[model samples]
Target: MSDPILKARGLNKRYGKVTAIDNCDFDLMPGEILAVIGDNGAGKSTLIKALSGAVQPDSGKIWLDGQEVAFASPNDARANGIETVYQTLAMSPALSITDNMFMGRELRKPGLMGKLFRTLDKKAMEDFAREKLAELGLMTIQNINQAVETLSGGQRQGVAVARAAAFGSRVIILDEPTAALGVKESRRVLELILDVRSRGIPIILISHNMPHVFEVADRIHIHRLGKRAAVIRPSDFSMSDAVAIMTGAMEPPASMAA
Candidate 1:
């Protein structure tokens, strides 16, 4: 693969006696879905948090496009074109899709109204939001002004992903995006993942569902004991094999025998 768009080396984080991450190394190739899998407490979430700037690692170096950098907060990561959509989606339930998309980074009115009164550019925000949602095939939304709380689980997921795709210029991190939905809804989200990847944005997916991981991930990053155990291609490892590796019931393939 070409130089990874995102790379990390020697990442470590600890919470008192518990070590959340242990000298981990990671990479995300451009335009590939890299699924991260592990058993409970395997530090998968911690690794993501560190990458997303939700938690500061004790020690590590991160490189985006081969330039070393540090993220002080989630906003810092977002500014650098790394967006994360957690399980909760972090959206205001009562707000419209347009409002949710521009919650913090809202556009303002032009001239004196923007300077003195500080009014928002609602039309511009709505137009952009509608375009993004439509790109994701979310035309079921009859009105962009409809409150997010009125949407179904799958539609809600679509909205969250659309918001990410609209902003995430480099990479998008999805954490168990299908955890709570039914099979059909889950499929919808999986399709959405592929749709996002098709647009040339690399995705780092953290999921426990082996089937979902297998279906969408181009490569699998098996994490165990707070560190990366192996990085394998989907074609090289079966679902059961990936599960065994993640649970430490089996060792990595012979290629990792070194």
Candidate 2:
């Protein structure tokens, strides 16, 4: 079997007295959508935090592309080609679409204007942003320079996903991507997710929406009590079965245990 593109083992995290994650393990394969489902406070956030470099595990190891690595912050993860589109969307409402896409990692001009004066290459950044959005069919956005706040919720989500896809060379982790959208918008975001995966980058989707998970995920990772309970394919298990495994109503077979 091909090794997992992203993997975690023996991950543990605690908040002084409370354990957020305990001996947690995870795996994400190349070019596939891995849905992580868990109840509130089930340590799913903590696990994702560790992987994305938002939180450090008390003890554990993470690997990407077959090499072990550690991250001190989200920037570190981004440096290693791991990008996360948080639930909040994390964009500056007043900024233009191109600005939001290249927020922290803006491109600089080539000559002294860039090197000595630290000038930004706005055209380069805009061109790249426009290309990425067009590639993802988000050109429905009338203006590339429009403020993010002017767009609808689904359009904002599309911009965020497009940003991740543009720079997330290895993997993209999305948290509750469709939580706040109506059915139509949610469907668009789902299609965007599949489009990103179609480009060969694996995605780790953290969501509570079962139908969405069943629709896009190739394999579902069931998390419970701060650990992965089982990994099963939507093709082989019903949505109800995934819920049962997540809530401890049913025990997955030994083969499915993570």
Candidate 3:
């Protein structure tokens, strides 16, 4: 599409005798949801880890916005405007929604209090947090001050996604966001994914649910045998065909032959 906002080539990673990723190549177009799917132990996680800077690929090249770059850690990736939402959600159960939203990147009071005492700007953070949640259709909660533990699984997921949408200026990566959610909650999370994409930010999703992948992903990147086997549009590949390709039951489309 548009000169891929993120691109990788010949990515490889190994742990002792195990090869986690092998010669993997990937691309994410701007403002599109690119879903990466594979069976267990198929190196899907490793591929994402490498892309998100959670793990380093032994040999490869990464280009962000067409400039060759390297990430030494997850923080480095975040600094480069790439935010990842792990399945864990990474929220403090006892913290307020506003607190969780501004956990590491909290704002401070203006001028003296902010400079001398370094006090948190709770009002500002809460106001912005509410606005973000509202934009994502997650404003049903009666209190933003309530502990995150009191929120439903879907609500918690929404908060995490809201945080990402608020700050992930370049790209947002989600790993199995709906795996632990119920049918209705999962559906809500899917809608949130689309909402996030509509904001003009590209997304990279890693999911195992075939139905979810088919429903939300504009394009699918099939991972097999520790590498990318094919990249196909959802319109060109059925859910059954995608699964077959992941499990080696069917050959990839000839146009995508690598």
Candidate 4:
């Protein structure tokens, strides 16, 4: 019910003659989890890319914290407290957890000369990484110096999620976060997502898992053929209704369909 932390109005994206996304509107409220569900080629990725600043929308306005803004790049989005965890996991397998955590934004200590002054503060970074991991309920990780490749699929996801949270984002967008994980791993990731929501940060969860969406999302937004089909509160819709809307078997709710 509070003002949204991120809002996309009339979001449109096109690839040559293919209209991937058209006139989509989305809003993520503070500490709320909004799930996006659609079949393959539903323009879910395109919408997320546009929202995260990975790609510019052909026509749309992005309002962050109630003010319209444009992001030139993903870094620009990050600087504005918007972070995204793509499906690919975007982490180096051989890199240590601490290194991966502070990959782009490393902490440095002052030294003798201006050129020689840039030395990484390993201890501080490791300590902070441990705290972050703990906050994400990944306290089982005993070593921040271990290579990320050594972690399990769920653990690796936890690392990626921790990195996103550590960046101090007000809104976090996760794309198919539990897509490839096993049942247990998927549940773990879902728990992590709920944990993130409880921390007062809004989340845009892009998933095809209807059951999972019903379980974790506060509201469901169905995208059908690049347009928003419907936005339904979990309490008002059953899984069958959600699937029906997603697959075009039923008409969208009036406000969203308009």
Maximum-lDDT candidate:
2
Say which prediction, candidate 1 or candidate 2, comes out ahead on TM-score.
2
For candidate 2, the per-residue lDDT at 37 reads 97
C-alpha RMSD values across all candidates = 1.1, 0.8, 1.1, 1.5
TM-score, cand. 1 vs. native: 0.97
Q: Residue 102 of candidate 3: its Cα lDDT?
A: 89
**How accurate locally, in lDDT, is each candidate?**
0.91, 0.95, 0.92, 0.88
lDDT of 2 at 62: 97
The prediction achieving the highest TM-score against the true structure is 2
Count of backbone clashes, every candidate in sequence: 0, 0, 0, 0
For model 3, the stretches where C-alpha displacement exceeds 4 angstroms are none
Local distance difference test, candidate 3: 0.92
**By lDDT: ranked, best first:** 2, 3, 1, 4
lDDT of 3 by residue, 157-256 (tens): 9999999889899999999999999999999999999999988999999998989998989999999999888998999878999999999999988897
Give candidate 4 regions above 4 Å deviation: 111-117, 255-258
lDDT of 1 by residue, 175-241 (tens): 8899978999999889989999998999999998989998899999999999999988888778888
Model 4 CA RMSD to the hidden true structure, in angstroms: 1.5
Give residue 108's error in model 2 in angstroms.
0.9
Per-residue lDDT tens digits of candidate 4, residues 106-144?
A: 888656532487778888899999999999889899999
Order candidates by TM-score, high to low.
Answer: 2, 1, 3, 4
Report residue 38 deviation for candidate 2 (angstroms).
0.6
Q: For model 3, where is the 10-residue window of minimal lDDT? A: 249-258
